[model samples]
Target: MDLSYTERERAFRDELREWLAANPPGERPQGEEADYAWRRDWQRRLHEGGWAGVHWPVEYGGRGASLMETAIFFEELGRARAPLPANVLGLLLGGPTLMVWGTEEQKDRYLPPILSAQEIWCQGFSEPDAGSDLAALKTRARRDGDGWVVSGQKVWTSGAQFSKWCMLVARTDPDVPKHKGLTYFLMDMEQEAVQVRPLVQITGEADFNELFVEEARIPDENVIGGVGNGWKVALTTLMNERAGLGFFLQVRLRQLLDELVEQAAASGALDDPRVADRLGDLHVRTEILRLTAYRGLSAIEQYGQPGPEGSLVKWLWSDTNQMLTQLAADVVGPEALTAGRPWAYELLRARGNSIEGGTTEILKNIVAERVLGLPRAR
Candidate 1:
């Protein structure tokens, strides 16, 4: 696999780097609301500069960037330490999923707001009982007059409080099999029927929310793919979820590793063979994740599907991040373990990395069955 960037690709990276240097997203505010507003305004700057939807088609108000260029865009964002737009679910998962399955009117109405951050979006796939086995979701939406009334509970919804729309999957046909009976809806989150309560994590922050949706009404026009085809449409969103953010995440991991290495060097821990060996192993593993992510991107761009590397990268990233944070605790000492410290927060947050997006165990199962051609574990 040729990993070298071409002249044009290098030029693209340079231009993006220049833009980020000029228009950096300054310090984030203290409160959650202020921080969200700060990111919203940053997204507005990206939209104005034609950088919001870098991977989107030019006809759809994006740059029509190549796959490599898209990776570079994310890399630069991480390198500059810029926060992702507050409407990340919209830009990454919702808009792309809509582009694949949305009608002309749907695209016209939804896509522009997503790019501009005028409307935030969130995912409503996971419930209290159905996360790993997403097809087992119990949330139901009954057909009403020219619409549907949805009622259920969703957990770990990242931006539900701020989102204007939710890419929701609910059971619309109970008689059929679980996987076949689902329907995808663009559920409106602003109504009285939808309630959001923050889930305070171990980090003492509510980065996620539990959505208690009661009789939430959705218009017929808001059905994403079709009735009983929600599973397929939701699969599209899930695939995008695992694939699109890999680059940004990998870069962030690299940054953490760099910081840890700097700390180790300052503390003179790297002189020990054990410390050096572990650090070396992490560096190699991190590079492997980066390379594997690029290979997966190439496979999708060329073959229209991902290889095993896609699953492997996420698994490696989560494991590596957890390791990095733990190593920081050792090298950076007590400060890293203290409450409210950035390292402490990262250490706690890394625990959920293995579970979010997809779990390590589930990914291994996918790799075993799909990639290794092994028999399914019954």
Candidate 2:
């Protein structure tokens, strides 16, 4: 309930801010590969400075920061306009999930590379047919002599092209129920059976991909949390996916708002009372998003589970981003719709905000049934 940071938290924030100040993230370059290489180099710098994966345990080559400190890490990154380290999915989702359900060997093999950005990781949980409903996924893994062979397709897989490993969930026992039949595996991406094809977004970026896995081999040692227990392991990844990164994203939204305001002022849109009113409303909403993100972290720390703010923040963020971009289109007019412009790109990219991570409709159901104790929408 307290919004002020404790002395220790403040000290932690101060140290990070000083480090970030000394090591500023310079301007990001053009082109996808160049941008990714730049981020990878930045991640390497963070690792060398011991800033990457700050939330992971010290034994795992991290700073062993508390949940609040981890939130601060993300907030500071966004505040500094630092691109999230190249291995964000690994740090935020894969490493934490492995800590929960991976074997000692698995941890020993994967954790170090994840922190150092040596071996990039991607997720393969969402198939075209079974994105929202994980249990319904048709990706199948069958027993072989000493491993399992996976064969199926996964869509919306970001970073797949450059990844070395995939946190994959497949149906290992089709005879049983859908959810119970699943198994999680650390499938190697370099194998011949795996194919990665980029999916171009409205912004003309191919940050997402389609993965065609045809009999891809995962050694028996890579089965995480044991076969038929994938749903639980996947939930760990999903929970981590939703938690700390909201801080960074909410901060980024604030940055975009500031830019929009400056642009509006330059374009004389500030003179229009209607434009001013919308910008004011959006600024208030973005601030609310920031506060609710903190609330969610506190709720989880205190109650051992997320409060209403968990799903609420994600849902609100998606809608707020969409709304903010629409207002940009209005204030900036023709230039906003012009191709190759930043505002035009943001306007188009905001369309995916509602669908990515988790859909707004699905998040609403989660809040209603799980947080509000309401009946199922079904």
TM-score per candidate, chains pooled: 0.98, 0.98
Colliding residue pairs in candidate 1 = none
lDDT of 1 by residue, 1-378 (tens): 667898989999999989999998998789999999999999999999999999899999999998889888988998898988888889889988999999999999999999999999999999999989999999999999999999999999998899999999999999999999999999988999999999999888999999998999999999999999999999888877865578899999999899888888988998878889989989998999998999988998889887777779989999999998888888788988877889999999999999998899999999999899999889
What is the lDDT for 247 in model 1? 88
lDDT of 2: 0.91
Positional deviation of residue 378's Cα in model 1 after best superposition, in angstroms: 1.4
Report lDDT (Cα) of residue 95, candidate 2: 98
List the global CA lDDT of all models.
0.91, 0.91
Q: Single out the weakest 10-residue window by summed lDDT for candidate 1.
A: 238-247
Backbone clash count, each prediction separately: 0, 0
